[model samples]
Target: MKVGLYFGTFNPVHIGHIIIANHLAENSELDQIWMVLTPHNPLKKKAGLLEDYHRLHMVHLATEKFEKIQASDIEFKLPQPNYTINTLVHLEEKFPKHEFSLIMGEDNLKGFHKWKNYEAILAHYHLYVYPRISESTIPEQFKDHPHIHKIEAPVIELSSTFIRNNIKEGKNIEPMLPEKVWEYIDHNLFYRK
Candidate 1:
């Protein structure tokens, strides 16, 4: 089956993440979406990240109800400084039976050229991009990249960083996340030190 690899940190999966995955699964040709949780991104600071297992568990809890969506901890075992190209290459080798593609947001559109082995990725994989409200100023150079297609899924501006900060401050989080997601966060005391 053709699948979309929806890779992210998913430090604590929220309603927005689930909603987008469901939208793609329902509307797109993808059979399912695997939420590949990255343990560490080479380009970003690792200070605020929850443990890999915990993050995976959060994704597990958040996506429990969706048959077409799954949480993956594959990156936890892969070599560090995780890059998408390497992961895709590895998965293709391991699961030749399942064809895989990419799912991402528009914020990542401009930066795609800078990733390691970007050319190979563009040539090999089909990228399914959702419109991200935060990145309104994409450079003109990124306008016509090959293999990139914009999806019409409804967008949400909510972010995990904002949710994490709200939790740190002891603020109400129910409004920002789904009821089940809130329960999972509260049950695990995630982001509450």
Candidate 2:
């Protein structure tokens, strides 16, 4: 199986995530899209982040209906501050039959060169990048790289922060989330600071 790893904190899994995952799964050569729930991203601040299982549960809720997309907690079992390269290596060892690729936004591509062992990742796995509204240009080396595939997916400007902030301010963000995810968040009173 060819799988594309869509890594995210998914503080509260929203529709934008589903759209991108679905788009890649249906439009690309990937047979499956794994929504990898990162327990802690080295690049991000941990403040205001939900617990790992809560985030993972929200991801499950968001992706449960999709046939090609599924949620994963593979990183939760790995060491903290894990890099993409390490995860890829572990996945390859465990599931040797499956070819794994990366699913990232164009914004992330801007800093791809800074990642640990990025060259090794490029050599081993294909990167499926989707469009994001960002000012920075992708690195010169990756712009035309054969391994990096630029997908013409929709430009979804929505974010989990926006949803959390709106919910905290007593604004309705139900439409921005999957119906089940919204119910879970509402029932648990998540992100209501």
Q: Which lDDT values do the candidates have, in the order given?
A: 0.84, 0.92
Which portions of model 2 show Cα errors greater than 4 Å? 41-45
lDDT tens readout by residue for model 1, 43-155? 67776788777788878878888899999988877887777888998899899999898999988877777999987887888889998977455557656766677789988
Clashes of each: 0, 0
Clashing pairs in 2: none
State the lDDT of candidate 2 residue by residue for 66-108, as single tens digits.
9999999999888878888989999999999999999999999
Give the runs in model 1 whose Cα sits over 4 Å from its true position. Answer: 41-45, 139-142
TM-score of 1: 0.91
Q: Identify the candidate with maximal TM-score.
A: 2
Candidate 2, residue 42: the lDDT equals 58
Measured with C-alpha atoms, the lDDT of residue 93 in candidate 2 is 93
